[model samples]
Target chain A: MIRGLRKWAVPFAALLVLAGCGYDDTTVPKPEAVVTTPAVPTTPVKCDNKLQSYAPSDNRGAAIANLANKGRLVVGVSGDTLRLGSRNPETGKIEGFDIAFAQRVADELGVPMVVRVISAADRIGLLEKGEIDMVARNMTVNCDRWSKVAFSAVYYNATQKVLVRADAEKDYKGPQSLSGKRVCAPTSSTSVDNIKAIQPDVVAVLALKHTGCLVKFQNGDVDAITGDDTVLAGLAAQDPYAVVPKQGKLTDEPYGIAVNKGDVALARFINSVLDEMRSDGSWKDTYDEWLKPYLLVDATPPTPVYGR
Target chain B: MSQTATPQAAPPPAAAATAPAPAPAVAAKPTPGLVDTPALLNRWQLIGMTTAILFGVFSALIQFGGWQADGRAADDTEQLVRVQEIQSSLLRADALATNAFLVGGLEEPEQRKEYDDALESVLRQIANAAEAQPADREVLATLNVDVTAYATAVAQARDNNRQGFPIGAEYLSGASTELRADALPILDALVKANTDRAENAMAGQHPFWLLVLGIVALVALVWLNRELAQHFKRRINKGLAIAAAIVLVVTVVTAFAALLRDNSNDSLREGELATAVSEANARTAANDAKANESLRLINRGSGEGFEDLWSVSAKEVEKFASRDTRSGWDAYVAQHNEIVELDRAGKWDEAVEIATKEAGGSTESLDAFDQLSQQIVTANGTQATDDLRSGRVVALVLSGLTLLLGVAAAVAVSRGIGERRREFA
Candidate 1:
């Protein structure tokens, strides 16, 4: 009987011993899988389209192609720039002259769009990275931008103008005549630098963004706000400020699309789209759709000069 | 104190012989010395039951082993799949918004196809993953809600833009925030569940061996009882006989441990995969939203506020996404320069041309993103399912098998006792 008991124990003991021995002492080996490469690395090209002399330099096309493949475009704009690109709080879309212009380019690509809301100071860096595809937020064309991004054909005419406190227009002349006066400008903008060039000794306080400048100027922050005439006019239209500039113009501010430094393909595509829009009534329609509602504060925008 | 000591006083002698101590002693229990009860099992009755006990231990050990081998892997993979599903949907939503924005703020026929492709793929993936794990209904439902909200945001943003309002940025921003808040929580939960499962599976690998040893010891007891009954032609070896029943119990315990280990491992794998997928998805969505913000701000008017969002978003994606868009960024800069040149030359029309080009490129980028996202999501999802299935199978099959084996062993031993008793009579 004892012997039988010993034999009966054999089966379970054997199985247990077997299972124990079979149990892997080592950790499970993971299979070596192929590693995937990260997304390709490339530098974004930025350019000032307004610098083009009819022919878009090579950079324009490159910028456009870059935008095309991403399946979406990033543009720097404002939602409160009323009549130019401001959004209606109720509806929630950017409606303005600048927005209209943005739509025209987007329309040509048959793709999606992303608009980064920005103030003036953000345009340069945003354009430099692939952050915003282009700065259509009423950016001014200037030499500094030339080093950053390629420009397209001029689209809108803007000129250096002065915006004074609602009651300061009586004594103000122009840039040179504003010596010893405290003026505010949006930081890192051609307007500030340009103002410095003209009124070298004027007191200049640079606001990081247009909104900041507007807020400060409204609160008696500075004696004047100087920038492109159209922008100054638009801002003045919103408040009781008076825009004071030379009867003609100080500096030309033609708004253009900003692309990367070597995107010529994008430049041509933009040019073609522009040509189509200009003749097809889309340009006029966009301008009217965005600008007409807010023109009551000022005379309706002068006809946009389309260079032949 | 005297009352509590009564129980201990009674067991003082026998307790030293029978191995199992009270549950309260668990914390203070010496580990290596007590992992198995072979020492106390040296008694005649215990020795007689050793075979059955060893079997119990073996079954337990194997059950735990399978949990580690198959359970954890499955859990991690499944979790990753869940994350992928959530992430993919976010990416899809972003693509839709960008497309809508580009299409003149309306459903452009040309852009619709691309939108449809991206949207359908992501939605389908979410649905499929949800189906795979019906246990995670909360997460799936939340994701669905987020997708719907995102779609609405895109539509509204478009409508507003067409109507000439700049609420596009607001709508897109809201959508992005909503995704982060609503959908991500579920993903986190799912990931945790899987992670726990995997850890449990890992733990089972070792314990199952000891449990099998217990089972084998029980089988040994049963064999000895039958042998003894036959040898003396008597009813039973009472001590050895009853101990055989204990072997069955020990086997049941081993089975439970194995089952639990497998379940835990499965959950763990699923949790890990879900996290990874969720991360990727969130990144994609945020990037899409940021891009939309960029467009809206630029279209509204150049300003620093938009730039801030853009930079933050770009920096965020720089770590997760490939840096392939630099050329694209470069191109946009070039176009911006062209526009500037035209503006400088007083050629607004030509400058407008440049804007069109940059917009086109961005649109294209959004379109292609959907394709890549879909591919990767599908791959990750497949891996997760495979692991989940493996753990589930082991948890279910081994649990049932070990339990049945324990019951059968008990019945066989009990019947042998009856036969032996009759033979003695």
Candidate 2:
């Protein structure tokens, strides 16, 4: 019995030993792949300025009555633009020339004011959408925009110009000197389109917001920034190195309060409010409070141009 | 009679080898019985010894090949998943910070809540990963500090922005740069390292030695049964037959289980891991793009850098974007283009409005990005867990079953042999 068991054990042990060894090669894991994305350029809208005017409508219309009935004039204004409609950080309230104008309109209408913070792109859309009663956001009055939205008579006159490094202000005096140089401006605004139209050779860098252009200039990324003189002054005030050249007032940008296209009564009422502010010294006082220090020059308010 | 008696006393060497032992050695006259010498052991001893050795070898194969190897793979996969979680959360947190900064001073309640949630998740995931990967401890420590600094910078910026201070823009820029430069890169590196480890574990060569052992045992059982038949002159030996049958079944089961493990590991290494990495990278790019959009607004620079960043990152996101997320990305890109157009036209106020508006502007795009990113993370996470779990369960169950079958085969062999031995006794 022992011999028989020994014979079987030897073969079984040999099988076990043989089964314990063979070929194994380690496979290296594949590396991760990286993705690459490319940038696409934007196409800006062309300015179509064709100004319109209307005679004063009798009595408040449905739109004006609706707003009056609501007891609060819902007006859109910028909370970022320095002198026009900037927020007072201390008070946590928007207080500027635009806000002052909105308040005056609301007072004349005998309605409490409801200020809705808005962006340059939002002014017309909100007005058209009936989301707001009026847009007093330092909006430029132009012929093209007049086709889509009604505007009050021009209350403030600003000039389009270039803001450059203080030292380069003299060198880049006007649109003519900006040829072949990189200029930054906000998108969906007339400024970039105007730059493209007038200074075709200037490379236009479009920012999502106008403030973005200011930062770019500070970073030395752009040769100059072009916009309304008021906005340029605001940008200049923020940066000690930047200056709006006194000589280069590029174009006239008459500030107007935009309303819905067919709201003739609301347009007339807003126009009357502007006329009152202009004659009553309130407009001058508001301007002096917010913009005088930045202009560094004595100025008279622009005369209103109205026709029936 | 005289010759026979002489032979029994002292036989020729060759003839004596074939003869039985002398009767005097038995202690008494032998009863009539077939020879059962020590050299030719009882059937019970043969069956018990062969089956026990075979069963032991089979058990070793199952433990080493199926259980241990698979356990290691599962562990590696779990580590990789943790890395992914940390990375995804970090990206989301960075995006939230940028969003809050753009809102300017006292971030919108919704955005703040999201930011807080993302940060909390990141902190938790980092802790979990650190426990398993000691090397991650150092990175996690640095991340904690960086996140704190980022939060401080965001707070300072918010304060300045609330007060209408231009310095707020600079603060926001600083915070965004910190996230892009410090936190994100470290998270990415940790993910890469863990991914590599998982790949190595999953794609490793299976235990071919186990297969060899199983095959060898099956052959040995068959050979033993054949020998039993020839020696015993029986058509079949129930003990050896039963043992051989059980080994065959076990061998088949082991092979099938091995195949399942091989296929699962292959899919994980080749398909799932790659998809996970792609999805993660795309999501990161999308978030980076969104943050850049906010930066552009806060800084309001006319520089093309922000726009360029948006374009590239959006494209990267689109490459892996599913149908559900594609439109969101598309809408965002379209809205961004409009905002750019407005900004370029000297309509700074209008551009700001579109970019920062609460509805129907850039916010819509951001919402889409958020949805897509969450979806990708969720899908990849589920897939990773399922793949590893399935493979592990198969290995574990097969390992246990293989062991049980081996033991049963040995016992059956021993009992069959015992019955035969009893008949002889």
DockQ of each: 0.09, 0.04
Model 1 residue B176 CA deviation (Å) reads 3.4
Per-residue accuracy of model 2 over B296-381 as CA lDDT, tens digit each:
65444233567787888888888866556667777888887887786544344566667667788787677666667667666765
Q: What's model 2's TM-score? A: 0.55
What tens digits encode model 2's per-residue C-alpha lDDT throughout A1-308?
Answer: 34433544666557545543331312223345678686475453344433445544434444358552255677877756777776554444567878888888877777667666666877788787776778887788876687688888877888888888888866764687888888998877878778778778989997755666876776678988888888888878777788887775667888888888878788888777777777889888988888888987666777666674
What is the Å distance of residue B325 in model 2 from its true position? 26
lDDT of 1 by residue, B374-422 (tens): 4545555565556445545645466446535544454454344434334
Q: Candidate 2 at A262: error in angstroms? A: 1.0
- State model 1's lDDT: 0.54
lDDT of 1 at B62: 66
> What level of docking quality does candidate 2 show?
incorrect
In model 1, which runs have C-alpha deviations exceeding 4 angstroms? A1-80, A84-308, B1-80, B99-110, B116-135, B139-143, B181-373, B387-425
